[model samples]
Target: MSVLPDPGATRAVLIGTSHYDHLESLPAVSNNLTALAEALTGPTSWTLPQEHCTILSNPTTAEMTMAAVRAAAEQARDTVLIYFAGHGLVDPEGDLYLAMPQSKQRRVETGLPYRWIRQALLNGRADRCVVVLDCCYSGLALGTMGGPSDLADQAAVEGTFLLAAAAETRQALAPPDETCTAFTGELLDTLQTGIPNGPELIDFGALYRHLRIRLAAKGRPDPQARDRNTGARLALGRNLACLPTTATTPSADGEPATARSWPSPSGIRTVRGFFKSLADVRVTSGLTHQMVSQRSGGRISPGTVSRLLNRESLPKTWHTTAAFLSACGVPDQQVAEWYAVWTRLLTDTTTDAAPHTVPHPRQHQKPTTLQRLTGRLSRRNGRSRDHRSGSS
Candidate 1:
């Protein structure tokens, strides 16, 4: 469904620091690593092959050197994901540093510098990269929110994305009694039980949104994410736990997941196009009408969903649109685009323009290539022409 290639092979580096020789010990840090490692290697989340994953728990300089050990996992065209959970510190100049067992205050050199980490990923041959930091000053790893995030140009900018749990000035909260920190707990929950309903393949940006909403409802700090998905979606993995199972596919019922592909049209154009595209994503996503209603917890009825997909008109409110989009596997970034298009079209067809008078480009023709650079897909002369984005 995405214009990009299926994310090649996957490799991940998991780091968690809890023990500091002089600073306070974070017992929850170790828990975060253990649970996350299981989820990554487990068939539910990233599904990273064991040999392809490197996990370091409170590792010392000798065991985990960010620069020296040029992890060869990036030597091939693959998806490189690196995750860190622990204490983070900012230097006098306000750069982020990862705190390991040997990290010391007032000495920036003793900590893992964000630049070196960036260099390590940049030097690799990975096709796509993801950096997730669950620490106080994680924002240092990537540019702060509202800064230029259109990194989809250089490998340093586009291929590699960053997800920080909190702002540079705030401390990452670790609520007592939870196996992991609050940020990671919400992250794990999203992976375990899909965003809307089933394990529809999605990018880090989508995951970050779900995590932010869940944490915010519980009075937690907002999470920040730097994305490369504005052009083409970069999915992490397909979690079987989130999808329905049939005789041929894996399910939450413990059936082994096998290789498969979901059905998705090339692209869409009008409000009618949105519903048609959404219906395709929903059916292939393995979520039934019953699953959709249950996931909505009775706020949405199955009959309503069936009628909504009839393409008679866009939903009357933003809440219904969000629930339907969630069920349809639409990411947070794309949801705004869908809603904007719906609002304009809904007004045109009802007020400014005659009903069913809007130009429905190629309502019956098949699309060839979807735009990789933009969301605009139009039909001219009965052929689809993509308004592509600039090269990344």
Candidate 2:
């Protein structure tokens, strides 16, 4: 039988969360989301458009996530990609559901249903939809959902693919030094640097094997990992890079996609400037400062706060950026504005604004007792530990 091919246009939604108010899981989920967002949308060797993807971190509920998924599916043209990194729990029936930010550990039944995600894929119009889940015990729940025969049947009827971190009984880890869960991090590393060509041209089976070998090396072999890993393997009947029959020639409405490249120095300065403004607002508006600091998990020191406002330093790493943004409760739209401004500063040469001079760190304010306590707790938890399958 002739196999159907993936459609040309692609849209994606990425959701990540770690700190659940009552879920008892630490704040590792958001880290994976931020990392995946940066890898997928950042100006890397392989580029996916910033506009085409939406990211939600520390969502209030599974319903909220499902809403986002529905919206993305509605917007997609040919393909839809959904990635989630968070806690996974099973019910008495052994069905799996991803835990949301407001999830209660004791009230596991309230979590979002995995079937909802599956249904979303089955209903979407896209020729193909891929879902990547990263969480402990994620595989267990995912394993019962369906198999290759079902997937083949589904693909024949409505195209969809599912990738899970590990088997139902196995746990997926988030290593301390790493930004993403082991499965996601390795998968992205392979996708970004390992793929000879981008997704369109890459061999799905080879990619699956590569991911399996990488995960096995980590020593936490997921039981369902092998089955799902191989069963999900796909080979596009035709070259994905080639345009579809329905694809039109370049026109005003259908211009050839091009990446807006930026110079290193300009991009850095713009990012610094934007964060500096945010810091200034935080310092000037006590309410903003309190809100931002509280949201960030109380990790911001008075000195660090001062430095950030003064534009003396911003978080050097993406993790820090994620934390700061999380703490500040910066909305995605605002972040999108910052991204636009930064991109403009990098690409627009007509505006030759000089870099602002950074002020010295404020001297009077001391680290609050709450800050100290949270810092101690965070450290005691070994904040730098990466969450991997094998790592406790």
Quantify all predictions' global Cα lDDT against the true fold: 0.60, 0.52
Give lDDT tens digits, candidate 2, residues 114-226. Answer: 77877887777665576776654322222121112122222122355565665533344556566555676776677555544334323445556667777788775442222
How many residue pairs in model 1 have overlapping backbones? Answer: 6
* Tens digits of lDDT, candidate 1, 218-239: 8767777776645225555454
lDDT of 1: 0.60
Mind sharing the TM-score for model 2?
0.49
TM-score of each: 0.56, 0.49
Candidate 2 ranges with C-alpha deviation above 4 Å? 1-8, 42-46, 106-109, 138-158, 195-200, 223-392
